[model samples]
Target: MSFTFFTPGPAQLYPTFEKHLQTFVSEQLGSISHRSQQYRDLHKFTVDQLRTLLNVPDSHAILFLGSASEAWERILFSCVELESFHLVNGSFSKKFYDCSNALNKYAHLFEKPMGESFVASEIVVPEYAELICTTHNETSSGVQMPVAEIHKLKQRNPGKFIAVDMVSSAPYPELDYSLIDTAFFSVQKAFGLPAGLGVWIVSEKCLQKAESIRNQYSIGAHNDLPTLWKNALNNETPATPNVMGIYLLGKIAEDFNKIGVQTLRKETEHKASLIYKFIEKQPGFSTFVKEKANRSQTVVVTNTEMPSADIIKHIKAKGMVVGSGYGKYKATQLRIANFPATSVEDVEKLIHELGSL
Candidate 1:
């Protein structure tokens, strides 16, 4: 039986994943050395594809790392010298705040309830905080901050650096990269690929800031922004990287490119609207995020009348898996991802089965 995963993050597999893997092994992409010209070509190809796909600027350096969590650590340690302000909305966003604190920076926050988003105009950032962090999508709660709100934040605080966590929301609701200093995501979610790869896009300003403080303290060995920036200029990493993930991502990105981000965005909106409509009509379930505008276009979280696990089991029995609630809502909420790889037909089928239950 084929299982379709609706759970967020490492959710569904890209439709072309199998063919790409077979070719990956046949082409021996894994065996190539990091320093080889072949590896450089692969790296450059992926970077170029991502820059075009994500509308990334030439001023930014694209680096592949371990995970989004690692990117969180690097961003805080490298970009901020003393303090960083965070717009915390859920578990993942809070973690970024905690990460900066763990590194001994004075991290301030304007925290909101889960499934709630911030009012960008109402936020007051401290003058001392060097970086302002915001999660573009709170995967755990399915709350999405609008692009206009982020632009407002950037406009209000021109001097402060902005870092956005687009973990589950990238490749849709396209961002104007000029407003933010950096953004990062793991391919496991939106890209519909296997895990273990995190893409970090950092602007030139981040590189200069890190270099200025490089002698003051060490953020990390090779993964530091300065090193990642220096090495990426040559289409390389400071260490042996995820060659396979990079290749798969580039190929998958090419597929998204062919389809176009605007088309994917429309498809995402359509699928998400269907799921939300079903939630409203269904007696046993309700959309988690109260305000429709704050609801995430990528990760759709619903509150079930019965325990979420039972609902998950009910869905799983049919060879379909939906995510259980995250953190405190574990038994009461379920997360569903409407990523690029999940087709409209598949989503309609899933909705049909869900309605029957």
Candidate 2:
């Protein structure tokens, strides 16, 4: 039997979106100039549609980069001061902090214990830091921070800036931009598009911070804040953007707006719940994160009493591919993704097929 259930970064593309992407490329085939008016119009429409769909405030500035990873570095290199606090709950998050430390920035990590949740109680964020960064949904461990709680923390820490890596979290509802200064995500994951495109939901404060830093220090071409912001506001890029990828992403936002974020959130919750329930019933499997309240709606990480390699091979032979553990958890875990393109039927089919494994 033929099957498909891989849930890594590039999950699956929507059929309708695929057709739209083809038309986009055919129309803009020879368009080499991203600074052209056509490109600017497309870019402006994308940013505007995104802001409307994501409920971003008008008091903010948004940008697009080649990749979300680039956005991470840009936020750190341009906006962050000499020091910042990094909150680590999983491997990818830890890597982000390590990158910050490599830049000679003061990175104080608050790592949570394995199989447990990250509580903000032990994190002592310094008063004079440039920003506080966290991942809203951890792809490595399948844990999601309650952004409502993060917003509450922001309320308490009035002057400190907040940045979020919402790479896999933006498709669902919790994109509460009221408290966050910079929220960045790639288009490939939950956005259901190809890679090489990133969306940045940047706040006015982030722009101000970036501007101040550029004025004080001689910024490099790659990290030029003023040019990046101006180009982004004009719906163009300082460098050539992935025009094809971005055009499709704008259509995705349009589709999401038609259905609404709340509806998508509900759909994701139902799909994730199906898989989680199936895992709970299996003898050799259990969720990586014990607390259901903390489980991610997009990625679900599980622990197997059986050898994880055997489990992975078994599932792959059946045509369903899942993610392995990252960093220290490689041998002990399996991850499943249930994002926007992953339908309820797909979840049910995977659960049934896993039974044969």
Candidate whose TM-score is highest: 1
- Each model's backbone clash number: 0, 0
C-alpha RMSD of each candidate structure in angstroms:
0.9, 2.0
Q: TM-score per candidate, in order?
A: 0.98, 0.93
Candidate 1 Cα misplacement greater than 4 A, ranges: none
* Candidate 2 Cα outliers beyond 4 Å, as residue runs: 1-3, 29-32, 218-220
| lDDT of prediction 2 | 0.77
Model 2 lDDT per residue over 1-357, tens place: 645545658777654687777788788634757878888888777887788888888877778787788777777776676887778877778878987877777877778865555555545787667778888888888888877757766776768888888897786746667777888888878877777887777777777777788766543477356788777767778877778877788888888888898898899889888889988998878888888778888888888777677878887786677777766777778888887887787778778876666
lDDT of each: 0.90, 0.77
